[model samples]
Target: MSRTIRALAIVLGLTMLVAGCGSSSGDSASSSASSDGKFTVGFIYVGPKDDFGYNQAAYEASVAMEKAVPGVKVLQAENVPETAESEATMQNMIDKGAKVIFATSYGHYEFAKNMAEKNPGVTFVHQGGLKGDTKLDNLGTYFGTVYEPVYLAGIAAGSVTKSDKLGYVYAFPIPQTLANINAFTLGAQSVKPGIKVITIATGSWCDPSVQSQSVKTLLDQDVDVITQHQDCTKTIIEATEAAGAYSIGYHADASSLAPKGWVTGSEWNWTPLYTDIVKTVKDGTFKGSKYDGDFRVGLQTGDNPFVQSKYGSMVTDDTKALIEKAKKSFEDGGSPFAGPVEDQDGKVIYAKGKQPTYAEVETMKFFVKGVVGKIG
Candidate 1:
C-alpha cells in the first residue's frame, strides 16, 4: 500500500479548513510546523495528495482535523517513501514542533515505532496495524474495517458482471489487501455462485505503467468488472472505464473518474475518527485513552471510517437491497467470512456457523475458493 513520490517535501498546509473533500489547505504558504501558539499535527503519505485515492482521503481528513480540533495546524509531506527517508522526514517534523504524527501507511509502522520510542513526547499512530510493541503508551495503531464495504461492492460487481469474471488488480498480498480480496470473493459468491475473480498482483502500488499492463492482462482474460487495492487508483479505474469494464473503487470516491464504469466502492471517511483522536490529543487526554492502543472500528462499533460509496446506475434495486441486508447482517454480528468458507484447495478454512474475529481476519493468509491468485 505504498508508492514512490516524484517531488517530496513537507508542505505546511496553514490554509483555513474549507468545505467538502476538495479541501484547499488555505494557501501553499509554508511555515514552521507549529507557530503562533498552534499545536502541530504531522501526516505523511506515500503518494501525491491529489491522486484521487488514498492520500487524498487522508489529506482531506487532516485538514478537517485541524479545523475540528482547536489551535491545531497540519503539516503534510506527500510522496513520502517507506524508507529511512520516512524516518528522517518524521524526525524533521518533530524537530520543528509536531506533537502527534499519523504514520498513514503500513510500511511506516516500524519506522513510526522507532521514532515513538525515541520521542516519547510525540504520540505516534500507525494505520491498519495492531499494537505489537506496546511497552510505551505513545505508540498505537488504528484502522476501520475497510474490508466490510469492499464486500458490499463485490455484491454490486457480481450482480453486474455479464461474463461472471471479476478482476482484481492489487499491490501485494498483504493481510489487509488479502482480507479485502477474500471478502469480495465471498460476497460475490453469495450472490453469483461460481463467479471467478482473476487477480493480477502488480508489486508496486502506484506504478502507472505496471498498472496499465495489469489492466490489459485482466481485460484480455475477458474480465467484465475490475477492482483494486493500490495506493494511487486513478490509472486502473480510468483504464477499466476506457475498456468498458465495471470498476469497484477503493480508498476514495472515484465515481466521477469512471462515470460509465463506476459500480459502488469502499472509501475512507476518516474525518470523524481523525477529529476525535486529535481532540483527545489537544485536551492532553490521549496518553491512557482508548486511542492509546489498537483501535478498530466498524458497523458493529457504531461507526466505521470505511463506508460504502454511492451506488452506480448499473446497480439494480434488488442488488442494493441485497447489499443493505448483507450489511445489516454484519451489524447484527454476522460476518462476510461467516463460513463454510474454503481455501484455494477447497480446504475448509472456517466451519459452518463459525467465523473469524475482526482481529483474526487481519492475519488472513490464503485466498478463498473463488480467487484465481496465489498467496505468495
Candidate 2:
C-alpha cells in the first residue's frame, strides 16, 4: 500500500476451547511435541505473494527465515481473501503439520484464534490485530507503527509540492488507513502550513486499475504532490511522471518506480520480528506470547528496514537536512501523531495542539485539518 507526499482497532472477546474449560489434555499433549524433524511454518496472505506491497514484505521475511534456519520447511497460500476461507485454509495448514502458522491478514484474526484453539500445540501468529482475553496462549498478534515513517514521507512530499495540494490514494477506510492519512497530513502541515491532503479510497488493497484511476482522478483535479496506501506503484509513477509532480511511496521503496518524481516511502521490514520469533521457537524458549510489530520492535531501520531513497538529486540540501532531523527525532522516540488530531468530518478528535495519546493514535478514525475527501 504508494503515492506522493500528500497525506493521508480492537475487539477482544473470544476464547480458545482447547485453552481452558473444554480442552482435552490428550489434544494438548499431542500438540506439544512434533514428530517431524523439520521446523514447519505456514503463512497465509491477504493478497498475492508478489504484490510488491505489504504481502511482499511478509513473504520476504518468510523467505529469509527459510534460508536462515536449517531444516526448515515453509508453506504458503497466497491470494487468500478475508472471508470464511481464512479459517478453513488455516485449519488445513495446521492439519498438514504446520508447527508455526502466520496468518497475515487483518481479516484473518478470528480464524487464526479459532484455529489456534483446535491445535493448542501449534503457535499461531497474526499481523494487524489485538490480543483478546480468550485468545489461545499460543496465539500472538502484531502490526507495525509505520505511520511514523509515513509521516516522514509526508514531510518530503509537502516540501516538494508546488501547489500545496496533495493527493492520497487509499485502500479501505479502516482505522489503520485513517491513522496513516492523519499522520501524513500532520507531517506535511508541520513542514508546509496550509497544505491540503485530498484523499480517495479505492476499496481495494491490490487493484492496480483502481489505484491507477484514483491517482489519475486526483491529478486531473490539479493536485501537485501525491501519496498512496494502495498496493502498487504503477499509478503513482504514472501520475507523478505525467504531471511532473512529486510523490512519496508506501509499502516498499518506490523511488525506483518513479526515479524522476519519487521521494521516500514507509516500507515494512518484518525481519526482526520474524527472526526473533523463529529464534525463540528454535531455542525451546517459546512462551506462546503476543508480539507487537509497532515502533518499539518492528519499524527499526536495521531490522524493520523502512527507507527514504533520494529523489534523484532533486532534493535540496536544506530539504535533506530537514528530513534527516525528523528522522533523528523519530529515532529518538518522537511520535508522528504527537498532536492535535481530527477526523475526516472535521471533528476535534484530539483537541487543539494536544498530542494524541497512544491509545488515541492507534484507534484514530479521522482526517486532520487539511485532508480533503470522504473517509470511504
Candidate 3:
C-alpha cells in the first residue's frame, strides 16, 4: 500500500479501537471541581522532557502556565512514544483529573483525535497536525511560523561559516520541515550571497545516535556550521563542542549546549498561547473548531510566539544588525518566501513583486537553489 493509504488505515483502526474502549472514570472527574477548586491540565510529550529541544520547550511552557494561572494543576507524561501507547498515556492523564490535554507531537495526532471523539468533555490540543480542527469539535491544532526566527538564525550561520558551505540536519521532508530548510537557506543567502546548504535527512526526530552520525557526516563534508530541525540538542552539542563547528539550534535556547561555538537560534515562546487556551477553557469560551494558533501573531503583535536567542559574543556586530533589521521587516508584514524565489530546478515558484500566502507556504514541497538534497 502507498504510504498515505497505509497511514490512513492505521489511523482508522486506532480510532475504532480507542472509541470501542470508551471513556473511563477520569472523564467524569475532569468536569467536577477538585477539593481546592483547581482545574488540572495535562501534557503528553513524544520525547524526554530534558532532551533540551522540542519537548523541553513545551515542558517549560507548561511550567509557565502553572505559575501564571492560579488554581491550575499541571500533569505531564514524558517520553510517551507516538504510537498506540500514547492513547493509554492520555487515558492515564484523564484518569488523573486532567480536563484538557496537549499532545505535543505530530505523530500523536491520531491518538489525540480518537480520545477526543471518545470523550467529548475533555479538550485536546495537538501540535503540527492539520486535521484537528476538522476531525473533531473538541480538537484544535497549533504551530508557530518558526520560519521567521529560522531565517534570522540563517544570517548568523551564513556569517559564521568559514567555508560558505553550511549543513542542516533535518528529520523529515514534509512541508513544515521543508519550509524551515528553505527559510534558513533564504535567510543565509540574503546575508551572504551564493551560500550553499548541504542537507541530510535522518528520517527520525529524536534519535540521538542518528543525529550524532549526521553531524559527523556533515562535519566531514567540510561544513563549518550546522543547524538542525530535530527533537534534541544533540546536533548542536555534538557539532559545536565535539566537532568544533559553529551551530544553530531549534525549539529552545541551546546556547549553553555549545557555549563557544553557539550562534543565535530560534525558540518557541508558547507561554502566551498556552495561557490563552487555558483561560478559554476556564471561561467556557473555547472554540476548538476555530482555534488555529499561529506564530505570525507572536511575531507581529508581541505575543512572543517566536523568539531569536541572543547572538553569541562570537557573532560580529554587523551580522547582528542585519538580523535585527530582517526581524523588524517580518514584524512589518514582510515574508521570507517573497517573489523572485526559485526552486532547485531553477523554476520560479513565486514571481517577483509577490508574496506567498500562509496556505501556499504551508504546502511548500520544493527546495530553493543552493540547497543540495532530495526530499522523498
Report, for every candidate in turn, its global Cα lDDT versus the true structure.
0.86, 0.71, 0.81
Best candidate, lDDT: 1
Candidate 1: count of backbone clashes, pairs at least 3 residues apart or interchain:
1
Arrange candidates by lDDT, descending: 1, 3, 2
Candidate number that wins on TM-score, 1 or 2: 1
In the predicted model 3, the residue pairs found to clash are none
What's the lDDT for candidate 2? 0.71
lDDT of 3 by residue, 1-376 (tens): 6999999999999998886455321232234434566798888877667767777889899999999998898877776777887888888777777789998888998898899899898988887777612646677877778788899899899988889999998888988889999999999999788999999998887678888888888888889888888876665565556778887878777777788888888887889888888888877766532453332353555565768887887899899889889888877878888779999999999999888876677889999999999986
Per-residue lDDT, model 3, residue 65, is: 94
* lDDT tens digits, residue span 1-376, model 2: 1233222201111245334443221122123223567787888887767878888989998889888877777777776667776777766666767778888888888888888778888887788776646635677776666677777778877888888888988878877788889778888888887899989888776677777777778888889888888777766667677777777877877776676787767777777677777666656556643342222332333343444544545667787778778777766666676545556566766655566544566676667788887763
Q: Model 2, which residues run further than 4 Å from truth? A: 1-36, 206-210, 288-311, 342-347, 351-359
Best by TM-score: 1
Of models 1 and 3, which has the larger lDDT?
Answer: 1
Lowest summed-lDDT stretch of 10 residues in model 3?
A: 23-32
lDDT of 1 by residue, 265-341 (tens): 99888999988888888788998888888888878875799999998898999999999999998998788999999
